[model samples]
Target: MKIHINQLEEGCILAKDILSASNKVLAYKKTIVTEHIKHALKAFLVNEVHVENLLEDGRGFLPSGIQKEASNEEKEKVELTPVKTFHQLYNHAVMERKQLFTGWQSGTQIEIAKVRQIILPLISELKHQEGEILKLYQYCKKEDYLSHHSVSVALLSAFLAKRLGYDQGEINQIAITGLLCDCGMARISPVILTKKVTLTEREYLDLKQHPVHSYNLLKSIMSLKEGVKMGVLQHHERMDGSGYPLGVKGDQAHPYSKIVALADTYQAMVSERPYRSKQSPFKVLEQIMQHDFGRFELNAVNELKKAVIKFSAGTKVKLSNGLKAEIVFVDEQFPTRPIVKIEKTGDITSLKDKKELYIQEIF
Candidate 1:
């Protein structure tokens, strides 16, 4: 039975793992509770937990002494708005983007004003409630690739921009860059874009020209900021000089471009595509820090790391071994391998030392 943490008594067995806001396991299922465990739960900010056998004894309700009456004003202040509305708003934004991209493909001129209209409301909402926005993204399970990717990049870029200390106006510009960075993809043939098979060399080269296409399209927007235009143009450019269009390296690429590039890469990695399943965001972050270190800007990468940790810290995860666990801790030095508590056993394992274990998914 589910019970408030304050109502928990010593010797009660947990019926399910209690996860923190970030989805980390605060207490494992089946663990025999003790005073020490109760303290730990409080420290982790847990308010409720499920106890096995409690309901069977007809003791599911909170004890009278433990139940505190709340004033109507206080209850109203704490009431939660429905998250469904946010999801609907997100979906509407995506559909608007889809229409915008479709119009661009049909020879409609790209308008900065229209693009801003399509994204600004969503961006404002995200800025106000980032955690809720992230949770919606993580669990919504929608599959419209172009629109979903665009929105994801926009949100991630805005977040990174904020972390880098950009002013509000500049941050909004960065978001616009992310939203329109892949506008060139609309010019590509849908067959190639959604192909389940690998592209031939010529096809690959043709696909790589989207950034240039995006740049040429956006160049027509007279009121658009040069930095925003350049960000879209150079987002595919790499720090190690291995990126497409022009292989500018190091300081050659615009800072805003680097920010979009990192966000774009991360969003794409975690998103599902026709040819591959989506990867866990944590695993992708680890890969970026390890194998792709020099290919992305260090500052941008570091800021993104912090954002990912904040958004994913307490998320429930499944390991490669098929065991269900909750992430209890995220190690700064070894992010890919966070400490997780096994739900069934209450045993904590550090992914850093468990070379054979890795996170497979987040839920």
Candidate 2:
């Protein structure tokens, strides 16, 4: 049977090959109709729908407005690269983590170097498509905390480094730094890592010391450079000198460290933490932008804003009204209220320009 993509979950079957028809999709699969899939499908269909609100049964659907229809030639030009499934990304992260962390000793420089080497290429792969990282963040599941967030942060850090115009060598080093930045957590007691209850003051202090713990573990690795070691040490440092292991401030903090700090916070906020649910990516980005510039470099924040906007537009999202819509454009300066087109009617509405609705999250 045919189905809308929003209706399909993790294991649903594709009914048929998705093909372009005259004005509408003809041989599309059940997998092709999802709200998320539809946005990507637009690169193929070139047809964008506008979101709308109707007073009928409270069911959200698109309200028709100005219709910018897709052309056959445009459809032919669009190559819908089969989006790699998030589960596949998740599984890869999980396998890699297990392989690297198992039988590990504290200060196993050889093992750490090997892990860094293996992960650098993957980070580079993701950096080239930073937009994909944003998309993957939207699709991430909550349960697999370790693998998913680790890869996401690495990809994010790599993307940030690239945006800053770091050469390939620097990007690889930073990416490797990000991937292994949290390796110290592996040394902490699992109970503390996944603790359900609030920690005692002593436990809190211990947790905050992870960065130093991380640095100590990495200092012996002859293969790692000063930048890489500094990355692990300063990833948590805030611009205001509130960060741990050393409240190193301003230019004293390495640029790669700054990028990792921003990436780590953004990924952590968007990914599910043990104590809290994941915040929406848009919300997380906005929050970071709003914070005092000293906490994160202004230039880094600006670059991050670009990465968020690139992959975020045309993605399926949940709005404050609980209606589903596709992001149409981003207000680069505003960062939070993006222009969205409601799914049913294909109207281009701006959340910032129009005051009626606000975005809740990427679904």
Judged by TM-score, which candidate is best? 1
Query: Where does candidate 2 have its weakest 10-residue lDDT segment?
Result: 46-55
> Which segments of candidate 2 are over 4 A away from where they belong?
1-90, 105-110, 138-143, 344-348, 353-357
Residue 282, candidate 1: how far off, in angstroms?
1.0
- Model 1 has an lDDT value of 0.79
For residues 1-363, write the lDDT of model 1, one tens digit per residue.
778888887667778877654355555665666666776676554567888756555343334443333334423322233334556767787888888988988989898887888777677667666775334335323347888889878888888888899998999999999999999988888788878778989889889999999998989778999998899999999999999889999899998999999989987888777677777777888899999989999999888777667766778989989999999998787778899999899999999999989888888
Best by lDDT: 1
Cα TM-score per model: 0.75, 0.70
State each candidate's clash count: 5, 14
What number of backbone clashes does candidate 2 have, counting pairs of residues 3 or more apart or in separate chains?
14
Which window of 10 residues has the lowest lDDT sum in candidate 1? 74-83
lDDT (Cα, 0-100) at 45 in candidate 1: 46
lDDT of candidate 2 at residue 247, scale 0 to 100: 92
RMSD of model 1 against the true structure: 14.0
Local distance difference test, each candidate: 0.79, 0.67
